[model samples]
Target: MRLSVIAKVLALPVVFFVCFFLVPLSVVLMSSLWVQNQLSFEHYLTILLDQYHWSVIWVTIKLGIYSTLICALLGYPLAWFMIRIVSTPLWRRLLVILLIVPLFTSNIVRSFGWMVLLGRTGFINETLQNMGLIERPIRFLGTELGILIGLVYILLPFMVISVGASISRIDRSLEYASRDLGAGHWETFRYISLPLTLPGLAAGSIMVFALSVSAYVTPALLSGGRVTVLPMLIYQQYSTVFNFSYGGALSIVLLLATLFLVAFANRLGSTKGGDK
Candidate 1:
Protein backbone atom coordinates (compact mmCIF):
# COMPACT_ATOMS: atom_id res chain seq x y z
CA MET A 1 0.00 0.00 0.00
CA ARG A 2 2.83 2.44 0.90
CA LEU A 3 4.64 1.51 -2.32
CA SER A 4 1.46 2.20 -4.28
CA VAL A 5 1.12 5.58 -2.60
CA ILE A 6 4.70 6.44 -3.48
CA ALA A 7 4.11 5.45 -7.09
CA LYS A 8 0.99 7.61 -7.23
CA VAL A 9 2.91 10.59 -5.88
CA LEU A 10 5.60 10.15 -8.56
CA ALA A 11 3.10 9.67 -11.41
CA LEU A 12 2.55 13.37 -12.11
CA PRO A 13 6.22 14.22 -12.21
CA VAL A 14 6.99 11.27 -14.47
CA VAL A 15 4.22 12.30 -16.84
CA PHE A 16 5.46 15.89 -16.79
CA PHE A 17 8.98 14.79 -17.70
CA VAL A 18 7.66 12.65 -20.51
CA CYS A 19 5.51 15.42 -21.93
CA PHE A 20 8.06 18.21 -21.64
CA PHE A 21 11.65 16.99 -21.42
CA LEU A 22 11.64 13.52 -22.92
CA VAL A 23 9.37 14.42 -25.84
CA PRO A 24 11.40 17.45 -26.88
CA LEU A 25 14.67 15.59 -26.46
CA SER A 26 13.31 12.72 -28.55
CA VAL A 27 12.46 15.16 -31.33
CA VAL A 28 15.95 16.59 -31.33
CA LEU A 29 17.48 13.11 -31.36
CA MET A 30 15.37 12.13 -34.35
CA SER A 31 16.07 15.40 -36.14
CA SER A 32 19.79 14.98 -35.59
CA LEU A 33 19.67 11.63 -37.35
CA TRP A 34 17.78 13.05 -40.32
CA VAL A 35 20.25 14.42 -42.91
CA GLN A 36 19.40 15.65 -46.46
CA ASN A 37 15.73 14.93 -45.78
CA GLN A 38 16.65 11.31 -45.05
CA LEU A 39 18.10 9.34 -42.12
CA SER A 40 21.93 9.37 -42.16
CA PHE A 41 25.05 9.75 -40.00
CA GLU A 42 26.32 12.81 -41.87
CA HIS A 43 25.35 15.46 -39.30
CA TYR A 44 26.95 13.60 -36.41
CA LEU A 45 30.08 12.96 -38.49
CA THR A 46 30.43 16.63 -39.39
CA ILE A 47 30.30 17.77 -35.77
CA LEU A 48 32.59 15.03 -34.47
CA LEU A 49 35.15 15.20 -37.26
CA ASP A 50 35.53 18.99 -37.56
CA GLN A 51 38.55 20.55 -35.83
CA TYR A 52 36.67 23.78 -35.05
CA HIS A 53 33.88 21.84 -33.41
CA TRP A 54 36.47 19.96 -31.32
CA SER A 55 38.01 23.25 -30.19
CA VAL A 56 34.62 24.62 -29.20
CA ILE A 57 33.84 21.47 -27.23
CA TRP A 58 37.17 21.76 -25.43
CA VAL A 59 36.54 25.39 -24.57
CA THR A 60 33.04 24.66 -23.29
CA ILE A 61 34.28 21.79 -21.10
CA LYS A 62 37.18 23.85 -19.75
CA LEU A 63 34.96 26.79 -18.83
CA GLY A 64 32.35 24.61 -17.20
CA ILE A 65 34.89 22.75 -15.07
CA TYR A 66 36.79 25.86 -14.02
CA SER A 67 33.64 27.79 -13.16
CA THR A 68 32.31 24.92 -11.04
CA LEU A 69 35.61 24.50 -9.17
CA ILE A 70 35.93 28.19 -8.44
CA CYS A 71 32.34 28.43 -7.24
CA ALA A 72 32.82 25.50 -4.85
CA LEU A 73 36.09 26.91 -3.50
CA LEU A 74 34.63 30.36 -2.83
CA GLY A 75 31.07 29.35 -1.95
CA TYR A 76 31.87 26.80 0.76
CA PRO A 77 33.66 29.38 2.93
CA LEU A 78 30.92 31.97 2.40
CA ALA A 79 28.27 29.38 3.25
CA TRP A 80 30.14 28.38 6.41
CA PHE A 81 30.48 32.00 7.46
CA MET A 82 26.78 32.58 6.94
CA ILE A 83 25.66 29.54 8.91
CA ARG A 84 28.30 29.56 11.63
CA ILE A 85 29.83 33.00 12.05
CA VAL A 86 26.85 35.21 11.35
CA SER A 87 24.77 35.05 14.54
CA THR A 88 22.32 37.83 13.74
CA PRO A 89 19.13 36.77 11.98
CA LEU A 90 18.59 40.20 10.40
CA TRP A 91 22.10 40.29 8.98
CA ARG A 92 21.77 36.77 7.62
CA ARG A 93 18.50 37.67 5.92
CA LEU A 94 20.09 40.78 4.39
CA LEU A 95 23.12 38.84 3.13
CA VAL A 96 20.89 36.21 1.57
CA ILE A 97 18.86 38.93 -0.15
CA LEU A 98 22.01 40.49 -1.57
CA LEU A 99 23.14 37.15 -2.87
CA ILE A 100 19.81 36.35 -4.51
CA VAL A 101 18.87 39.77 -5.93
CA PRO A 102 21.11 39.38 -9.00
CA LEU A 103 19.29 36.16 -9.87
CA PHE A 104 15.96 37.98 -10.02
CA THR A 105 17.45 40.32 -12.64
CA SER A 106 17.62 39.29 -16.30
CA ASN A 107 20.67 37.38 -17.52
CA ILE A 108 21.16 40.02 -20.20
CA VAL A 109 21.24 42.75 -17.58
CA ARG A 110 23.76 40.83 -15.51
CA SER A 111 25.97 40.07 -18.51
CA PHE A 112 25.79 43.67 -19.68
CA GLY A 113 26.79 44.84 -16.23
CA TRP A 114 29.85 42.59 -16.37
CA MET A 115 30.66 43.82 -19.84
CA VAL A 116 30.74 47.41 -18.56
CA LEU A 117 32.77 46.58 -15.48
CA LEU A 118 35.32 44.54 -17.37
CA GLY A 119 35.67 46.80 -20.39
CA ARG A 120 39.04 48.40 -21.25
CA THR A 121 38.21 51.78 -19.70
CA GLY A 122 35.85 50.37 -17.10
CA PHE A 123 36.13 51.06 -13.39
CA ILE A 124 38.35 48.06 -12.76
CA ASN A 125 40.98 49.20 -15.25
CA GLU A 126 40.61 52.86 -14.21
CA THR A 127 41.11 52.02 -10.54
CA LEU A 128 44.07 49.78 -11.31
CA GLN A 129 45.70 52.53 -13.36
CA ASN A 130 45.13 55.05 -10.59
CA MET A 131 46.65 52.67 -8.05
CA GLY A 132 49.78 52.15 -10.25
CA LEU A 133 48.83 48.55 -10.96
CA ILE A 134 49.40 48.92 -14.69
CA GLU A 135 50.56 51.60 -17.16
CA ARG A 136 47.73 51.00 -19.61
CA PRO A 137 44.24 49.56 -19.62
CA ILE A 138 44.18 45.77 -19.70
CA ARG A 139 41.72 44.13 -22.06
CA PHE A 140 39.11 42.06 -20.22
CA LEU A 141 36.16 42.21 -22.57
CA GLY A 142 36.16 39.48 -25.21
CA THR A 143 38.57 37.37 -23.13
CA GLU A 144 38.23 33.96 -21.49
CA LEU A 145 39.03 35.50 -18.09
CA GLY A 146 36.12 37.91 -18.45
CA ILE A 147 33.73 35.09 -19.27
CA LEU A 148 34.97 33.05 -16.29
CA ILE A 149 34.43 35.98 -13.95
CA GLY A 150 30.86 36.47 -15.17
CA LEU A 151 29.93 32.80 -15.05
CA VAL A 152 31.33 32.33 -11.57
CA TYR A 153 29.55 35.41 -10.22
CA ILE A 154 26.22 34.26 -11.66
CA LEU A 155 26.51 30.65 -10.37
CA LEU A 156 27.84 31.39 -6.88
CA PRO A 157 24.55 32.07 -5.15
CA PHE A 158 23.27 28.60 -6.01
CA MET A 159 26.36 27.06 -4.43
CA VAL A 160 26.10 29.20 -1.30
CA ILE A 161 22.43 28.41 -0.73
CA SER A 162 22.87 24.68 -1.27
CA VAL A 163 25.86 24.34 1.05
CA GLY A 164 24.36 26.73 3.61
CA ALA A 165 21.17 24.69 3.87
CA SER A 166 23.20 21.52 4.35
CA ILE A 167 25.40 23.12 7.00
CA SER A 168 22.33 24.44 8.85
CA ARG A 169 20.76 21.00 9.02
CA ILE A 170 23.91 19.47 10.56
CA ASP A 171 23.63 18.82 14.29
CA ARG A 172 25.68 21.23 16.37
CA SER A 173 26.21 18.54 18.95
CA LEU A 174 28.61 16.74 16.63
CA GLU A 175 30.83 19.79 16.37
CA TYR A 176 30.53 20.40 20.10
CA ALA A 177 31.63 16.86 20.81
CA SER A 178 34.61 17.25 18.49
CA ARG A 179 35.61 20.43 20.27
CA ASP A 180 35.19 18.79 23.66
CA LEU A 181 37.53 16.09 22.43
CA GLY A 182 40.24 18.74 21.92
CA ALA A 183 39.93 19.09 18.15
CA GLY A 184 41.07 22.45 16.76
CA HIS A 185 38.81 24.55 14.51
CA TRP A 186 40.48 23.34 11.35
CA GLU A 187 40.41 19.75 12.52
CA THR A 188 36.74 19.99 13.40
CA PHE A 189 35.93 21.30 9.97
CA ARG A 190 38.14 18.86 8.15
CA TYR A 191 36.88 15.81 10.01
CA ILE A 192 33.33 16.67 10.99
CA SER A 193 31.78 19.55 9.06
CA LEU A 194 33.34 19.01 5.64
CA PRO A 195 32.36 15.37 5.46
CA LEU A 196 28.81 16.15 6.46
CA THR A 197 28.42 18.85 3.81
CA LEU A 198 29.63 16.58 0.98
CA PRO A 199 26.09 15.99 -0.27
CA GLY A 200 25.41 19.70 -0.64
CA LEU A 201 28.78 20.24 -2.31
CA ALA A 202 28.00 17.50 -4.77
CA ALA A 203 24.56 18.88 -5.53
CA GLY A 204 25.81 22.44 -6.01
CA SER A 205 28.75 21.36 -8.18
CA ILE A 206 26.45 19.42 -10.49
CA MET A 207 24.03 22.35 -10.75
CA VAL A 208 26.83 24.80 -11.50
CA PHE A 209 28.42 22.51 -14.08
CA ALA A 210 25.16 21.79 -15.92
CA LEU A 211 24.23 25.47 -16.13
CA SER A 212 27.72 26.45 -17.19
CA VAL A 213 27.71 23.88 -19.98
CA SER A 214 24.53 25.33 -21.48
CA ALA A 215 25.21 29.01 -20.69
CA TYR A 216 24.70 31.20 -23.78
CA VAL A 217 23.91 34.80 -22.92
CA THR A 218 26.77 35.40 -20.49
CA PRO A 219 29.34 33.73 -22.76
CA ALA A 220 27.94 35.44 -25.83
CA LEU A 221 28.09 38.90 -24.28
CA LEU A 222 31.38 38.37 -22.51
CA SER A 223 33.16 36.59 -25.37
CA GLY A 224 32.20 39.33 -27.87
CA GLY A 225 32.19 36.66 -30.63
CA ARG A 226 35.92 36.13 -30.12
CA VAL A 227 35.49 32.76 -28.45
CA THR A 228 32.91 30.29 -29.62
CA VAL A 229 31.35 27.54 -27.52
CA LEU A 230 29.10 24.62 -28.51
CA PRO A 231 25.88 26.46 -27.69
CA MET A 232 26.91 29.38 -29.91
CA LEU A 233 27.51 27.02 -32.81
CA ILE A 234 24.14 25.39 -32.21
CA TYR A 235 22.43 28.79 -32.13
CA GLN A 236 24.14 29.87 -35.33
CA GLN A 237 23.08 26.68 -37.05
CA TYR A 238 19.43 27.15 -36.10
CA SER A 239 19.23 30.94 -36.35
CA THR A 240 21.68 32.05 -39.04
CA VAL A 241 22.14 29.04 -41.28
CA PHE A 242 18.62 27.65 -40.75
CA ASN A 243 20.10 24.14 -40.59
CA PHE A 244 17.79 22.45 -38.12
CA SER A 245 19.34 19.03 -38.77
CA TYR A 246 22.85 20.18 -37.88
CA GLY A 247 21.53 22.29 -34.99
CA GLY A 248 19.68 19.29 -33.64
CA ALA A 249 22.88 17.28 -33.81
CA LEU A 250 24.74 19.87 -31.76
CA SER A 251 21.87 20.06 -29.30
CA ILE A 252 21.85 16.31 -28.77
CA VAL A 253 25.62 16.29 -28.27
CA LEU A 254 25.40 18.98 -25.62
CA LEU A 255 22.54 17.18 -23.93
CA LEU A 256 24.42 13.89 -23.94
CA ALA A 257 27.57 15.53 -22.54
CA THR A 258 25.57 17.08 -19.72
CA LEU A 259 23.89 13.77 -18.94
CA PHE A 260 27.21 11.95 -18.93
CA LEU A 261 28.69 14.47 -16.49
CA VAL A 262 25.66 14.36 -14.19
CA ALA A 263 25.71 10.57 -14.18
CA PHE A 264 29.41 10.54 -13.31
CA ALA A 265 28.83 12.98 -10.48
CA ASN A 266 25.96 10.87 -9.17
CA ARG A 267 28.12 7.77 -9.24
CA LEU A 268 30.91 9.52 -7.33
CA GLY A 269 28.34 10.87 -4.84
CA SER A 270 26.96 7.37 -4.29
CA THR A 271 30.44 6.01 -3.67
CA LYS A 272 31.14 8.74 -1.13
CA GLY A 273 27.82 8.09 0.60
CA GLY A 274 28.51 4.38 0.74
CA ASP A 275 31.92 5.03 2.25
CA LYS A 276 30.20 6.95 5.02
Candidate 2:
Protein backbone atom coordinates (compact mmCIF):
# COMPACT_ATOMS: atom_id res chain seq x y z
CA MET A 1 0.00 0.00 0.00
CA ARG A 2 2.83 2.39 0.83
CA LEU A 3 4.55 1.50 -2.43
CA SER A 4 1.32 2.22 -4.26
CA VAL A 5 1.08 5.59 -2.54
CA ILE A 6 4.69 6.40 -3.39
CA ALA A 7 4.12 5.52 -7.03
CA LYS A 8 1.03 7.70 -7.11
CA VAL A 9 3.06 10.63 -5.71
CA LEU A 10 5.69 10.17 -8.43
CA ALA A 11 3.14 9.71 -11.24
CA LEU A 12 2.61 13.39 -12.08
CA PRO A 13 6.26 14.29 -12.44
CA VAL A 14 6.98 11.09 -14.40
CA VAL A 15 4.13 11.81 -16.76
CA PHE A 16 5.24 15.45 -17.15
CA PHE A 17 8.82 14.44 -17.95
CA VAL A 18 7.73 11.91 -20.55
CA CYS A 19 5.21 14.26 -22.15
CA PHE A 20 7.48 17.28 -22.25
CA PHE A 21 11.14 16.30 -22.42
CA LEU A 22 11.40 12.71 -23.56
CA VAL A 23 8.70 12.89 -26.22
CA PRO A 24 10.00 16.08 -27.83
CA LEU A 25 13.58 14.76 -27.71
CA SER A 26 12.52 11.50 -29.31
CA VAL A 27 10.76 13.42 -32.07
CA VAL A 28 13.91 15.47 -32.72
CA LEU A 29 16.03 12.31 -32.83
CA MET A 30 13.65 10.76 -35.31
CA SER A 31 13.68 13.89 -37.45
CA SER A 32 17.45 13.93 -37.50
CA LEU A 33 17.58 10.32 -38.57
CA TRP A 34 14.85 10.70 -41.20
CA VAL A 35 15.93 12.33 -44.46
CA GLN A 36 13.70 12.19 -47.58
CA ASN A 37 11.34 10.00 -45.51
CA GLN A 38 14.09 7.39 -45.15
CA LEU A 39 16.39 6.69 -42.19
CA SER A 40 19.91 8.03 -42.78
CA PHE A 41 22.96 9.24 -40.86
CA GLU A 42 23.84 11.91 -43.43
CA HIS A 43 23.21 14.92 -41.23
CA TYR A 44 25.35 13.57 -38.39
CA LEU A 45 28.03 12.58 -40.88
CA THR A 46 28.12 16.06 -42.37
CA ILE A 47 28.47 17.67 -38.97
CA LEU A 48 31.14 15.24 -37.79
CA LEU A 49 33.18 15.13 -41.00
CA ASP A 50 33.15 18.79 -41.97
CA GLN A 51 36.12 20.86 -40.86
CA TYR A 52 33.93 23.97 -40.59
CA HIS A 53 31.54 22.16 -38.27
CA TRP A 54 34.46 21.00 -36.16
CA SER A 55 35.71 24.58 -35.87
CA VAL A 56 32.31 25.76 -34.71
CA ILE A 57 32.15 22.94 -32.18
CA TRP A 58 35.60 23.85 -30.93
CA VAL A 59 34.63 27.48 -30.59
CA THR A 60 31.48 26.53 -28.70
CA ILE A 61 33.41 24.31 -26.31
CA LYS A 62 36.16 26.91 -25.89
CA LEU A 63 33.69 29.61 -24.94
CA GLY A 64 32.00 27.29 -22.47
CA ILE A 65 35.31 26.44 -20.82
CA TYR A 66 36.44 30.05 -20.64
CA SER A 67 33.11 31.23 -19.24
CA THR A 68 33.04 28.44 -16.64
CA LEU A 69 36.63 29.06 -15.55
CA ILE A 70 36.09 32.81 -15.30
CA CYS A 71 32.88 32.36 -13.32
CA ALA A 72 34.53 29.89 -10.98
CA LEU A 73 37.50 32.17 -10.38
CA LEU A 74 35.36 35.22 -9.73
CA GLY A 75 32.47 33.48 -7.97
CA TYR A 76 34.48 31.42 -5.49
CA PRO A 77 36.21 34.50 -4.12
CA LEU A 78 33.01 36.55 -3.97
CA ALA A 79 31.13 33.70 -2.32
CA TRP A 80 33.91 33.24 0.23
CA PHE A 81 33.83 36.91 1.03
CA MET A 82 30.06 36.89 1.42
CA ILE A 83 29.81 33.78 3.55
CA ARG A 84 33.04 33.87 5.55
CA ILE A 85 33.80 37.56 5.92
CA VAL A 86 30.50 39.41 5.85
CA SER A 87 29.25 40.00 9.39
CA THR A 88 26.22 42.13 8.62
CA PRO A 89 23.06 40.36 7.54
CA LEU A 90 21.68 43.57 6.03
CA TRP A 91 24.69 44.07 3.85
CA ARG A 92 24.65 40.43 2.80
CA ARG A 93 21.02 40.67 1.83
CA LEU A 94 21.71 43.85 -0.15
CA LEU A 95 24.55 42.18 -1.98
CA VAL A 96 22.40 39.18 -2.81
CA ILE A 97 19.68 41.47 -4.18
CA LEU A 98 22.21 43.17 -6.42
CA LEU A 99 23.43 39.82 -7.69
CA ILE A 100 19.91 38.53 -8.38
CA VAL A 101 18.46 41.70 -9.93
CA PRO A 102 20.10 41.13 -13.30
CA LEU A 103 18.78 37.58 -13.47
CA PHE A 104 15.27 38.92 -13.35
CA THR A 105 15.97 41.04 -16.45
CA SER A 106 15.51 39.64 -19.94
CA ASN A 107 18.58 38.07 -21.55
CA ILE A 108 17.96 40.08 -24.76
CA VAL A 109 17.95 43.28 -22.78
CA ARG A 110 21.11 42.35 -20.96
CA SER A 111 22.86 41.30 -24.16
CA PHE A 112 21.93 44.61 -25.76
CA GLY A 113 23.37 46.37 -22.73
CA TRP A 114 26.64 44.53 -23.26
CA MET A 115 26.51 45.40 -26.95
CA VAL A 116 26.53 49.09 -26.09
CA LEU A 117 29.26 48.82 -23.48
CA LEU A 118 31.53 46.61 -25.58
CA GLY A 119 31.17 48.71 -28.73
CA ARG A 120 34.14 50.78 -29.92
CA THR A 121 32.72 54.12 -28.75
CA GLY A 122 31.29 52.55 -25.59
CA PHE A 123 31.92 53.29 -21.95
CA ILE A 124 34.60 50.63 -21.53
CA ASN A 125 36.60 51.89 -24.48
CA GLU A 126 36.15 55.55 -23.53
CA THR A 127 37.26 54.90 -19.96
CA LEU A 128 40.27 52.83 -21.07
CA GLN A 129 41.32 55.52 -23.53
CA ASN A 130 40.96 58.19 -20.84
CA MET A 131 43.11 56.12 -18.46
CA GLY A 132 45.83 55.74 -21.15
CA LEU A 133 45.22 52.00 -21.40
CA ILE A 134 45.18 52.01 -25.18
CA GLU A 135 45.97 54.36 -28.07
CA ARG A 136 42.85 53.26 -29.90
CA PRO A 137 39.53 51.77 -28.83
CA ILE A 138 39.85 48.02 -28.80
CA ARG A 139 37.40 45.95 -30.80
CA PHE A 140 35.29 43.95 -28.35
CA LEU A 141 32.21 43.51 -30.49
CA GLY A 142 32.33 40.59 -32.93
CA THR A 143 35.06 38.90 -30.91
CA GLU A 144 35.40 35.91 -28.59
CA LEU A 145 36.56 38.19 -25.79
CA GLY A 146 33.32 40.18 -26.00
CA ILE A 147 31.21 37.02 -25.88
CA LEU A 148 33.24 35.76 -22.94
CA ILE A 149 32.67 38.99 -21.06
CA GLY A 150 28.92 38.80 -21.66
CA LEU A 151 28.70 35.12 -20.71
CA VAL A 152 30.73 35.69 -17.55
CA TYR A 153 28.54 38.60 -16.56
CA ILE A 154 25.33 36.64 -17.14
CA LEU A 155 26.49 33.40 -15.47
CA LEU A 156 28.48 34.71 -12.51
CA PRO A 157 25.51 34.80 -10.14
CA PHE A 158 24.83 31.08 -10.44
CA MET A 159 28.36 30.24 -9.35
CA VAL A 160 28.33 32.68 -6.46
CA ILE A 161 24.99 31.47 -5.09
CA SER A 162 25.95 27.81 -5.34
CA VAL A 163 29.33 28.26 -3.63
CA GLY A 164 27.92 30.62 -1.05
CA ALA A 165 25.26 28.12 -0.03
CA SER A 166 27.90 25.43 0.38
CA ILE A 167 30.21 27.71 2.30
CA SER A 168 27.43 28.78 4.63
CA ARG A 169 26.67 25.14 5.46
CA ILE A 170 30.24 24.41 6.52
CA ASP A 171 30.65 24.09 10.27
CA ARG A 172 32.85 26.76 11.83
CA SER A 173 34.01 24.25 14.41
CA LEU A 174 35.85 22.28 11.74
CA GLU A 175 38.00 25.30 10.87
CA TYR A 176 38.54 26.08 14.55
CA ALA A 177 39.66 22.55 15.24
CA SER A 178 42.03 22.65 12.27
CA ARG A 179 43.57 25.85 13.62
CA ASP A 180 43.81 24.35 17.12
CA LEU A 181 45.76 21.47 15.60
CA GLY A 182 48.38 24.04 14.44
CA ALA A 183 47.02 24.49 10.94
CA GLY A 184 47.63 27.92 9.44
CA HIS A 185 44.78 29.92 7.88
CA TRP A 186 45.56 28.68 4.38
CA GLU A 187 46.13 25.17 5.70
CA THR A 188 42.77 25.20 7.52
CA PHE A 189 40.99 26.32 4.36
CA ARG A 190 42.81 23.82 2.19
CA TYR A 191 42.17 20.94 4.61
CA ILE A 192 38.61 21.79 5.64
CA SER A 193 36.77 24.55 3.77
CA LEU A 194 37.90 23.84 0.24
CA PRO A 195 37.15 20.13 0.42
CA LEU A 196 33.78 20.79 1.98
CA THR A 197 32.88 23.24 -0.77
CA LEU A 198 33.91 21.04 -3.70
CA PRO A 199 30.39 19.73 -4.37
CA GLY A 200 28.99 23.24 -4.74
CA LEU A 201 31.95 24.30 -6.85
CA ALA A 202 31.44 21.33 -9.16
CA ALA A 203 27.70 21.88 -9.36
CA GLY A 204 28.14 25.56 -10.18
CA SER A 205 30.86 24.85 -12.75
CA ILE A 206 28.71 22.30 -14.52
CA MET A 207 25.73 24.65 -14.51
CA VAL A 208 27.78 27.54 -15.89
CA PHE A 209 29.46 25.38 -18.54
CA ALA A 210 26.20 23.86 -19.74
CA LEU A 211 24.50 27.25 -19.95
CA SER A 212 27.47 28.79 -21.73
CA VAL A 213 27.50 26.13 -24.42
CA SER A 214 23.77 26.37 -25.04
CA ALA A 215 23.60 30.17 -24.94
CA TYR A 216 22.31 31.79 -28.15
CA VAL A 217 21.34 35.42 -27.65
CA THR A 218 24.42 36.81 -25.92
CA PRO A 219 26.76 35.16 -28.41
CA ALA A 220 24.56 36.18 -31.30
CA LEU A 221 24.52 39.86 -30.38
CA LEU A 222 28.15 40.05 -29.33
CA SER A 223 29.49 38.01 -32.27
CA GLY A 224 28.20 40.52 -34.86
CA GLY A 225 28.09 37.85 -37.60
CA ARG A 226 31.89 37.61 -37.63
CA VAL A 227 32.12 34.66 -35.21
CA THR A 228 30.02 31.52 -35.24
CA VAL A 229 29.25 28.89 -32.63
CA LEU A 230 27.28 25.65 -32.75
CA PRO A 231 24.10 27.22 -31.42
CA MET A 232 24.26 29.92 -34.09
CA LEU A 233 24.77 27.26 -36.75
CA ILE A 234 21.86 25.26 -35.43
CA TYR A 235 19.66 28.35 -35.48
CA GLN A 236 20.71 29.18 -39.01
CA GLN A 237 19.99 25.65 -40.16
CA TYR A 238 16.52 25.61 -38.72
CA SER A 239 15.40 29.16 -39.34
CA THR A 240 17.33 30.46 -42.32
CA VAL A 241 18.25 27.32 -44.25
CA PHE A 242 15.03 25.48 -43.38
CA ASN A 243 17.03 22.30 -42.77
CA PHE A 244 15.40 20.63 -39.78
CA SER A 245 17.37 17.41 -40.17
CA TYR A 246 20.71 19.16 -39.90
CA GLY A 247 19.46 21.35 -37.08
CA GLY A 248 18.19 18.38 -35.15
CA ALA A 249 21.54 16.64 -35.57
CA LEU A 250 23.36 19.72 -34.30
CA SER A 251 21.04 19.94 -31.28
CA ILE A 252 21.58 16.27 -30.41
CA VAL A 253 25.34 16.65 -30.78
CA LEU A 254 25.38 19.60 -28.42
CA LEU A 255 23.12 17.81 -25.94
CA LEU A 256 25.31 14.69 -25.94
CA ALA A 257 28.56 16.67 -25.68
CA THR A 258 27.23 18.71 -22.76
CA LEU A 259 26.07 15.59 -20.96
CA PHE A 260 29.47 13.95 -21.44
CA LEU A 261 31.33 16.99 -20.13
CA VAL A 262 28.98 17.30 -17.13
CA ALA A 263 29.48 13.62 -16.32
CA PHE A 264 33.24 14.06 -16.55
CA ALA A 265 33.12 17.02 -14.20
CA ASN A 266 31.00 15.09 -11.73
CA ARG A 267 33.38 12.15 -11.85
CA LEU A 268 36.40 14.41 -11.37
CA GLY A 269 34.72 16.05 -8.39
CA SER A 270 33.94 12.66 -6.86
CA THR A 271 37.51 11.48 -7.35
CA LYS A 272 38.85 14.64 -5.76
CA GLY A 273 36.49 14.25 -2.84
CA GLY A 274 37.63 10.69 -2.34
CA ASP A 275 41.26 11.74 -2.43
CA LYS A 276 40.64 14.45 0.14
Q: Judged by TM-score, which candidate is best?
A: 2
- Residues 1-276, model 2: lDDT tens digits: 999999999999999999999999999999999999999999999888899999999999999999999999999999999877889999999999999999999999999999999899999999999999899999999999999999999999999999999999999999999999999999999879998898899889999999999999999999998999999999999999999988999999999999998888788777876786
Residue 272, model 2: lDDT of: 70
Where in model 1 is the C-alpha error above 4 Å? 1-8, 268-276
* Residue 54 local lDDT, model 2: 92
Q: Which candidate's lDDT is highest?
A: 2
Give the 10-residue window scoring lowest on summed lDDT in candidate 2.
267-276
Clashing pairs in 2: none
Candidate 2, superposed: residue stretches over 4 Å from native: none
1-276, model 1: which lDDT tens digit per residue?
999999999999999999999999899899989887789989889888999888999899899999999999999999989988999999999999999998999989999999899988898999999999999998888888899999999999999999999999999899999999999999998999998998899889989999998999999999999989889989999999998889999998898888998898799878877897
User: lDDT (0-100) at residue 118 of candidate 2?
Assistant: 88
Instruction: Go through the candidates in order and give each one's C-alpha lDDT.
Output: 0.92, 0.94
